[model samples]
Target: MESIARQSVKMCPFMQRAGSVQGLQVLHNANLPAVARKCPVVGHAMSRAYATASGTGARRATAPEPKAGSANEMVANHATQESLFDYDGLFETEIEKKRLDKSYRFFNNINRLAKEFPKAHRDLEDDKVTVWCSNDYLALSKNQQVIDVMKKTLDKYGAGAGGTRNIAGHNRHALKLEAEVAALHKKEGALVFSSCYVANDAVLSLLGQKIKDLVIFSDELNHASMIVGIKHANTTKHIFRHNDYDQLEEMLQMYPRSTPKLIAFESVYSMSGSVADIDRICTLAEKYGALTFLDEVHAVGLYGPHGAGVAEHCDFEAHRLAGIKSLPDKSVMDRVDMITGTLGKSFGTVGGYVAASQRLIDWFRSYAPGFIFTTSLPPSVMAGAAEAIRYQRSHLELRQLQQLHTGYVKQGMKELGIPVIPNPSHIVPVLVGNPDLTKQASDLLMKNHKIYVQAINFPTVARGTERLRITPTPDHTDDLSDILLDAVDDVFNELQLPRVRDWESQGGILGVGESDFVEQSNLWTEEQLSLSNNQLNPNVSDPVLGNLEVSSGIKV
Candidate 1:
């Protein structure tokens, strides 16, 4: 009787769309196959690779179908007249005027690094630290070529756009950039947002609203903006554990396969510097009849073959910019969907973009509050980004040199007994173990040796996994490396901690425990504490006092 009732519930269209299982709604909407073979064309490469590595390729893959009810019909039946204005029954506490401890939050660690390494500054470190904390990978922020381009654009277009893209902001240069970006990704069309954050937020929210009964399956460790956008969608969402493909597959299998599904993720996670397996994800999405939205902010200038990102990068150079300098020559207008990126990090400017279809761009320009309500980026800024992008491609040697420096530092840290996470990426982090101790170590390095490293703590990282995020750029020379090593050695020794070498020799994982990593970095020692206490107490330490001569005529 109960089994029959469950089957009846599953047959209902509204129940399937709502993801109702066992009389309760679940997050995900689609069930995908265990193996990637369901999508033949895309998964062929993976299948072959897996087959060669393993003994057989006869593994069965299964995906559940939707019940009698359709997700589209369920969504259409539930549309509300005041849906846009409806704030009730939503997760109000998460969004509505929440308070946070702003005082202790790490808004910008780069600024802190500047204060610590004052002598390294080219200018006023108090005002501006000359240190290498900025991920301005292309040096576009200060590059003369970028400056020149900005000046030229400003001269031509004058300052601000004065209106949204739909208004007067949609200039020839903007269109050209969008086309160039779409070509870079080899997509049908691309849309540009003001910032990468804005792009993620707007894209997720807009897509969720546009698609009638959408279910989003997002990476657990996705950036905050993506999380915010997903929350705003107010529909069912599933969070798969960080990089756990099996777990993701399991979640997909349990979801009702009626509603449209979307997978949102990033290529390179900024904090951890972990790269995503995009091809696998895309394959899974396709198998489940889902679309993919990738944030290539970190990977845009560095990852792919032509820097298009993981998938395109693995394949081949999608688009090669010809000797043409200016936007377009009234030809080659149509392009693919948008790829979003920021000008700040790699491009060395301040703006963001989305490269998508003209229709999508037109729609976003009309609606998306972030794009519509906000002031557009200055023409000079866009010009600078354009120049930066071009400069990066032309000057491959310089970029290689920077990467080499990063490699040298990573190697140095490993040799010196620091437990750095293993990844080929440039950003290297030294596991410091605890939040308080990590902060103390950073302070000591700054005060004594003027070596600055930003201390990353929760909720940036999980609790008990705090670390010192050390970024080594090209400007950080070999001499600096020696100084840094020596300083770290001195500090570690002074703290009365066991040497990193001795621990490594014993095959012990350094910084894996509180005693190993946290307690070792504390600047204060038991002996030092005892001496301080003795001095503070007058009668307790008579020996040193008696040895000292009286200054006045009346001596004891």
Candidate 2:
């Protein structure tokens, strides 16, 4: 009896839109037999009877189906409603905003070079354009050694790691690469992630969430990844002024010494090319019982004697030059509790890592979902990264040549009266100050001059700080440099942009002595001028000196 009733229920069909309306009316109107209306199953049959009588069958046969422009359009229209939420309207508004502001990003599809690197040209509308905004600083992405290792590993292991690290994905290549990175930074252990951004986010989030009464002191200019991690952790955080050690110290003093604190910052700021005072930051961290989390993503595989990072270089340089080890308890690299770096930028591969004590690494490995849940990096990537790191370790000449190129471009820009952000680091930013102008200069450089330098604008840097960030590598030749400068000069003239400081009257040299030059450099705001003046060492000839003199018409 139960089986027969269930079968009857299964045999009943659901009514269409019009049938549903008529079926509801039949329930209100006493038009059915008492037995048919009283029994719930029979009542349902009566409703169906009323639906059929209401011309539902005729409506189904006579009404034509709605025609759709496309399958995607049909689905989109059905899924979205303007009354609830207008995703298309929101997108259109954002597009219009970007268009009006002239800050829309253009993705130029570039073909990989077989031989030439940093010096290689990109394919854009049937023209070969030189790229000046590549993050592959050392041009190791196209290195034959790195490529050969990756190819061999790919052939041996096949593509894709079959599972997460805890499963079948655990491989010798990843283990070896982790070990190599650990040794590079002189750490007890290291864990690899999909990217440096992920490493930073995972490690920071875990640390902030786990630590008791945790307080994160972050630089105001710290990257988006670090900010996201700290924000998600829901911990107390203090944002210090960019590169301002005094402000950082002041903030640290407010926090109790017993509280677990983390000083999170980057070694090299990408946009401005400003180097952080890592030594001083470490000192303050020790004074206030704070662990230093340094992101050396921009500095690793570029700076330092062994291409470890800036912290390593600073320590090595200090010991070699002054024979004065300022910190008695910890070496420079040791001062940093967590060091996050990437294989993508200078190393010229993909992925990121965090190097620290074995216990810290183990904690991350056990607790971090980003690491535990995601598929392990393929054997080829690990092999390639390991090879790249190994090769970079001994290649000091690449570093030197890169510095030379940076110095050449900077000095040339200064002589040409172009407003270049003065920094000791290997980045050169030509200030445009306006978004429209920045985009215009970049477009002119690409279309007319065949040179590509991306315009860095709002959210990347402040809105008024829009500029073209040019990165010169070891492979960017003297001829190429000349062409780039000339093209930039032409654009500046055409756009009627502001020129650099009038230092020609002061013997055509930019130094601390020239107050007008210092004021006009536009490297720092009024608040930063005093700090810059104090740090400017006029006698120093080293290109990496925080405040070094720029001689007129200087060339490499």
Q: Which candidate comes out best when scored by TM-score?
A: 2
lDDT of each: 0.57, 0.75
TM-score of each: 0.64, 0.75
lDDT of 1 by residue, 341-414 (tens): 77677777776766655466566656677776666677777667766665554443444445566667766776
RMSD of each: 26.2, 12.8
Candidate 2, residues 1-556, lDDT tens digits: the string is: 3343344345545323224444344334432243244356676885576567556454222222234333332221222111347899999999999888767777766664647554445644445678899999999898999999999999999988888877774777887788778767877778889998888889999988889789999999999999998987789999999989999999989978998999999998998887788889999999999999999999997776557787877765442222212335467888889999999999988999999987788788888887888888889998999889877766656776777788789888988889776677788888877898998898899889878888898879888778899998888878889999999999999999767553334333223224444422322223322222123222221112111011011135
Best by lDDT: 2
